[model samples]
Target: MEQTANKQTRLSQRVRSIQPSGIRRFFDLASKMDNVISLGVGEPDFVTPWNVREASISSLERGMTAYTANAGLLELRVAISDYMNNRFQVDYNPDNEVLVTVGASEAIDLGMRSIINPGDEVIIVEPTFVSYAPLVSMAGGVPVAVGTTAASHFEVLPEDIEAAITDKTKAIMICYPNNPTGATISRAKLEQIATIVKTHDLIVFSDEIYAELSYEKDHVCFSSLPAMKEQTIVINGFSKAFAMTGWRLGFVLAPPDLLDAMLKIHQYSLMCAPTMAQYGALEAMRNGMEDIEKMTLSYQQRRNFFVKTAKEIGLPCHKPDGAFYAFPSIAHTGWTSEEFAEKLLIEERVAVVPGSVFGKGGEGHIRCSYATSLVNLEEALKRIGRFLEAHDIRGN
Candidate 1:
């Protein structure tokens, strides 16, 4: 009787409704296979900078293992404030307007839960980060997806965003340089989107985790726009730029009232971000700009090489201007994204993410992360060419 009861335990409907990450599914498959060249997960191949790691080690040596204040170390917060102002032209007060969390992922969750109410709607521009919609749903907000096509370079249009807005709409969440696509919007385009948000009086969750990796031009911080600071929540972290993915340090910049609400949830749920990571982040904020520039230049070179080789090998892809991904159209293969991914992995030992898993406008494509070494990417693309040739799919 006890066994049966345990087996029949009810889970939250929200948890049951969402599917596991498609990116991870392929990553696991690749991990289990021999000689597989994976282009699936979007992690930087570089290790965290030595100085940042040293700072964390120094803290541990000093016996600083106690939990920080609920909002995180004020010194770290102050550094983040200065960094934002200097790098992105956005000013956030450190004392009451900034909150550091475990990672950008946690920051995103806090933002969603703090603002969402049951039956409220949040407009999500896709193909987008996978966590955006699910987090909104888990927060009791309806996720309304607004699709952007490859033809538009995957930049969400202001008209499309306006059309998606309803009386129930409460916020708009955007990521650029976007995950999986590496697309960036111009300052003018962001200004237009800002107008729509202002007109509708909706909140904006702007994820700028990849800001320092842009190749073509400088990234425009959404909160830096005129009159947008009060209405926008800026989510950023050291994971991408500083190659500090394992450090788990990220932060939020919002108005004091909005930040206070997020802090309440963060305080109760997490207490504060890891103390050592805070010290490391403070070091990163102060001295990691050079490391970011070096890593970004390497990624840009890899991107150029990968995109060029992909087109030469019959995979048509847009030249990504930012971030480290190349979303190539696989429509010519006459296979669904998942089908192509599976066959490619099985036949050629190259692992990539199926586009359909990223939501609307992703059906005929696959996302390839160039965050790995050029040697690995070259091998992967060469194998992909063989797969295409065997399938008799010709490039346009």
Candidate 2:
């Protein structure tokens, strides 16, 4: 027993230090329950467009199962390059500047591992995705969180980012059309952040996976800003907007040198993204704009109804500008986020992610995804309303 314990203790400290994802914990709990209405996972409810699906089926029928180059298929890379340039005004050289990965999740991990050295610090904007900080820590980097509040509509201000930087700070990771909070930064605000990056001489990992879903304004590609392309590593994928989450396809656009380093790590860990999924993504780039428009419109309508309903039920929600989540203040319920989520799950059969799980400044809130059907949203809202009434928290 002593020897077995010693062997287990020899595992990497880095792997042992991080906790399992808070979002996944609640998602699992919700999955085990009967008649649970889950707003915990941030996945779109729509299926992949039939055209894109058919492309993957055609690829399989044609026996295109063999791996392409270690980087990715040339045709897929070219398609992604053209898509980015045409849609976002960002140009990437398909031959050297783009790398397709297993998913945007892999791209994020690869970017950190390629850039970070032991003990380096990465500044993470909080009330964002759960994966950012853990991926940084796994890369032997320290994660310094800069919190964004609902009061500021969860925008990561330039000053806050500046304050978080230290001599050891190597990179800043940003996610816009943000998760959980659903906040987005304006073009002018992003330009201010770009200036800060230039002044600090730091690299940026911009996760624009939700870029196409922005309702009110076009998502300004961070790399498109003046002199920013070389310093910014843009990560995006087909999971959200194209409703291709199960396809597990994502890509990174970066300078050749950075792309080379990321490719080295990716080639070893993930030889290439799934061949069929790559084919699907290729089709999406070539012919899925109409599908994206339709999905975005549906999400916009859902966002409007969900936010309005939450406010009516006495939850002060910060209306999300992008993404399909509604971050509502649950402080008035006089319960911790976890407690509130637990009680709601048990009593009302509704599952929302506890805000505290998304790091600092996430306390006193709960993240409710509006990606499900309007019928589901209505039922969940009714259940939530009853829960609040039981607690004597009437709508204002």
Give the TM-score comparing model 1 with the true structure, all chains together. 0.98
Q: In model 1, which range of ten residues has the least summed lDDT?
A: 4-13
For each candidate, the alpha-carbon lDDT, in order, equals: 0.92, 0.92
lDDT of 1 by residue, 51-106 (tens): 99999999999999999999999999999999999988888899999999999999
Q: List the residue pairs that clash in candidate 2.
A: none
Give the worst 10-residue stretch by lDDT in candidate 2. Answer: 387-396
Model 2 vs. true fold: TM: 0.98
Q: What is the C-alpha local distance difference test score of candidate 2?
A: 0.92
Q: List model 2 lDDT by residue over 94-154, tens digit each.
A: 9999999888999999999999999999999998788999999999999999999877899
